[model samples]
Target: MDTVLTTRHLTKDFGRLRAVDDLSFEVKRGQVFGLLGPNGSGKTTTLGMLMGVVNPTVGEFSWFGEIPNHHVRKKIGAVLEHPIFYPYLTGQKNLELNAMIKQCPEENIPGVLELVELADRRNDKYKTYSLGMKQRLAIASALLNEPTVLILDEPTNGLDPMGIAEIRELIKKIAANGKTIILASHLLDEVQKVCSHFAILKKGRLVHVGPVDDVGKGAETVEVKADLPDFTEVLMQFPGTASILPENGVFLVTLREDFHSKDLNAFLIERGVVANHLVTKRKSLEKVFLEILSEPR
Candidate 1:
């Protein structure tokens, strides 16, 4: 796959604070790349610089191998922070204005509105639309130019569960059409479901970046649940094991790489402990994110 976006040691500072420090990553064409982190962890700042809304204090980045100039930025569509629109303007009118500004054909307005499922509501004033409707309209404005790369920051914010689901499905459909997507969000489950690749940021630093599956590989700890009160004492005998915590009458054991699920159950049975429920924890992107964020900066 060809690289759609690339940044080398990208750094952004706000006065004495480093908003983004030495951030380096690549986003490929036709892939959904997730930029994940907690609030104030520089996810938004990095995206701002990428969109050319804010300049980096240090390092460099490129979109489609070209510097972030007007000529190149035209091919990229972005919705940064929140969807901003004139409150009195109708959705269709707002899109018309956006089309004029982007130099896109006026014929593309209705099609973009339809893509976002807001064609029926296009005549409604922006202030009268719900949060989800506003968000979808914002997306429609971004799609006016038929950009190859779509960058969204917290796209699902302020939407109800059903609204979120609608946006999620829309994004999946958009990806299926071969458009590259760059999503910066704190919603871990959304990222896990939609992104093929991800990068974790914390304290303005890039702590982890790789394929989504590899983020938490080999970290499948197991949870043993039994009526036995001496589970802690029994778990202590397992060598090469990390800490074990007791929760709701179950023992959640974090094992080292040397141990497996079979080894854990066998060791327990060998000691005459009846295991009621023994299941390996499925590692998720959220777990990997927390693990990285909890580490020292």
Candidate 2:
């Protein structure tokens, strides 16, 4: 399927509070999609509705262009929160039990274990496994069915640096293998690092949606410092120079629409004004997110 999932004006309400408001987006096949929002922004609630655990108060959604139901859910594997397993059971034993419950073949066990890099520790007790290993085991359980799409809600939540790194690499590995992934995270850096496309939600409302690489496009400000005596005058005369301000002996130039840092540099050179320093400062995802949230809805 070209489209893995689609939500149409999906919304949820708990009494008077709207958990998710008019949410609509599409996840394409083979794309690592990220649902980004802060705590209490209805990310978990949205996932719950999509997974059939919580019913939506308004709107609808579909999986593979079919109505979502148990059968459709079977094609999608997910880990919504912390994973649970028998602490006393060995990793191998836990997966074996999971496979039995999932009705998947026992032969799928070894391959999933190897995929998560937990093969060597398969014999270790679940309680003895480190947090990262436990998380990986949880992901392995989700993958036991060989699902078409995998949904992870804060897969790296509460993880230390090492544990987060482990999950990060594992996610990249999974996405590389042609699985459509829907990842919900509050960590901006992680989303920027792994998600090919993303939707930003604030106060349960989708504020922005686009490819991750397009985050700071057309929003960059260039900082220029020239050795010439008329540096400020030269900068102001350049085409597309929207505004220029002196900051600590450097000029911060905001470019107009359709203008960029390269154009500015070329203009300076043509005018016989050589710059000693020029740096284009792109807005980070975090900065862009805050700006999005602060805008009027």
Candidate 3:
């Protein structure tokens, strides 16, 4: 139960193109796992293979530490494509219909609607709902079975900013409820916000995989600029200064392992050199993502 899913060398091909190449990773229980990449980078293709809708060219995967079977499938809920619901049907009615098809009890309808925050509007026709409401309804339908794992591909693809924010909060709420979530997205910022761990893919190959906190964790750098012309020289005298480089008229100073921005600032003041501008340049996930993709194949 600790390892929720595992893929070993899972691959897939279509004609002359390989959509997924030797991809391997693990999803742990209660983790918000992210499959991140740009379009055609195999995010959806990998999800398809895992959900058993698309067969792998070669390789294998397991769910709950066992080969995927009908039983295992029951423990997973997914929304791989844009959802379709009867526009005329009320939200509650639509969920009832979905529950019937999923063989889930009608009693689960009220709770699922409540969980998605659509309970207040449950009696409204699907046609009367906003785009965000529609998306929430799709998620509610997927949750009809109370699956242990939820798989969502580009859940907020076309939503407005408000819609996206709503979905993001809902996802966090779902994760807080102890369900394992596998989210595939090209939205780097969103992934960084919600996913505990992530694996990046490029042209069907896994380029990077690790916890979100470790994205840009090596060798910290600080951007410092002082009014003094000898600022760079003065900075070099500090014991914690690792390397100093000029970038955009400012000094990009790499700090030694034990060094921090506060330490550097104090050292500068003691040396009679006060920086006009000093700030720690924290690396964003978008930068790391571009760097990973830019590497030679």
Residue-wise C-alpha lDDT for candidate 1, range 1-297, written one tens digit per residue: 899999999999999999999998999999899999999999999988887888899999988888788767767788998999999999989988888777889999888888888999989899998888889998998888999999999999999999999999988988898999999999999999999899888878889888887765775588888677776877888884687987887778999887888998888788888788998888888877887888875
Q: Estimate each model's TM-score.
A: 0.86, 0.89, 0.90
Instruction: Locate the minimum summed-lDDT window of 10 residues in model 2.
Output: 211-220
Candidate 3, which segments miss by more than 4 Å at Cα? 86-89, 120-129, 245-250
Q: Tell me the tens digit of each residue's lDDT in model 2 across 123-185.
A: 999999987788889999989989889999999988899889988998998899999999999
Stretches of candidate 2 exceeding 4 Å from the true structure: 228-230, 245-249
Q: Give residue 71's error in model 3 in angstroms.
A: 2.7
Query: Local distance difference test, per candidate?
Result: 0.88, 0.90, 0.90
Q: Which candidate gets the maximum TM-score versus the true structure?
A: 3
